[model samples]
Target: MRAKKIYWWLVFSLSALPSLYFGLIYFLNPRQLGIDPVEVLLAESGQWAFRFLLITLLCSPLRRLKLRFLSRYRRMLGLFSFYYASLHAVIYVVAWIELDWPIFIQDLVSRPFIYVGMFAWLVLLVLAATSPKAVVRALKKRWVILHRLIYVAALAVMVHLWMQTRGAIGEVLLYGCVLFLLLAERLYRAVPLLNHQSVGKSANN
Candidate 1:
């Protein structure tokens, strides 16, 4: 039991380190961020948010490969994704828009990427809110359906990134491929014939 507690502590600490480093750099050495510090922060935090979200999606595939221990860390990874996403939103509001409601509203209307990104963030907010044991227990079967929105969130994020890219689409394409594979795996498992074949192979192994 103590070991389990230690494991979670380690997971949380490691997950928090990047945000801490980013925060320190942003606050202590704004010069290091170059002329477009706000843009830099927005990009970095937004990238990490998507990265963590992908990692959260990967937990299921890893578990299927017998790395069941990863399940314990999944919630932390998801929550960290939400944390970075919230930071990304905050930086946009404060640094980019300077808390100007009129500008924010205009951007929401004019920028489809911002609208999509905000929708993804809202989904993450809902997932994070219901991640607790009590909430999951209360929701029961409905929880599974609700959490499936993660895939929608992932799709929205991909669109958001694609729309935001100014030039090279290499990174966007890479993430798109990864998300594709993850979704494919889920679909593979959902099909009974394929799932049975996979189970047979696993048992034979």
Candidate 2:
């Protein structure tokens, strides 16, 4: 079952390759799409960014629901989230900024919100690189700590989406609600009652 889940994830992602292909082609030649190719790319990638972000969060909740196999592939889904985010950043730079390095640098410096997005991406790069088993074992003590950075990543993504499109507050609010609920669930599960019960059991032993 777990193997099939992973297989289907690959299949699903493969199905989306056409979008990436056209996105790239349209990027190289803006005249391909009758509509604004850049807008289409941005919208599609942004939707994907949020979708993957939600999936990453859903890993835990789905596991709580006894869908245990999901945990096996959380890292893969997370890396995909970062993948779409990177593409979103590329679209912003290549399509919107038109590869004007100096102007882009200036914009990054001037725009407060871009910092939010960039910081998230930086953390994501670290997370994606360290997703392997060897690194996780090597960083045993630090592994869990490092992965907790995903909360910050999620926040950064929300801010990125909120700021990038001025009127997309509805979508932003929806993501915000989901994130808040997920974090709250974690907190609830970590309550003193559960901790105390565990401690008492350990002491009795």
Clashes of each: 0, 0
lDDT of 2 at 55: 79
Question: Which candidate number has the best lDDT?
Answer: 1
Q: Could you tell me how far off, in angstroms, the CA of residue 60 lies in candidate 2 after the best superposition?
A: 1.6
Q: Compared to the true structure, candidate 1 yields what TM-score?
A: 0.91
RMSD of each: 3.9, 4.6
Clashing pairs in model 2? none
In model 1, how many backbone clashes occur? 0
Tell me the tens digit of each residue's lDDT in model 1 across 1-205.
9999999988888888888987898899977987887888989999999999999999888888999786768888999999999999999999988999999998889899999999999999999999999998999777777898899999999999999788898999899999999989877766775545654333211
Off by over 4 Å in 2: 1-34, 193-205
**Superposition error at 26 for model 1 (Å):** 1.3
Worst 10 residues of 1 by lDDT: 196-205
Candidate 1 regions with alpha-carbon error over 4 angstroms:
193-205
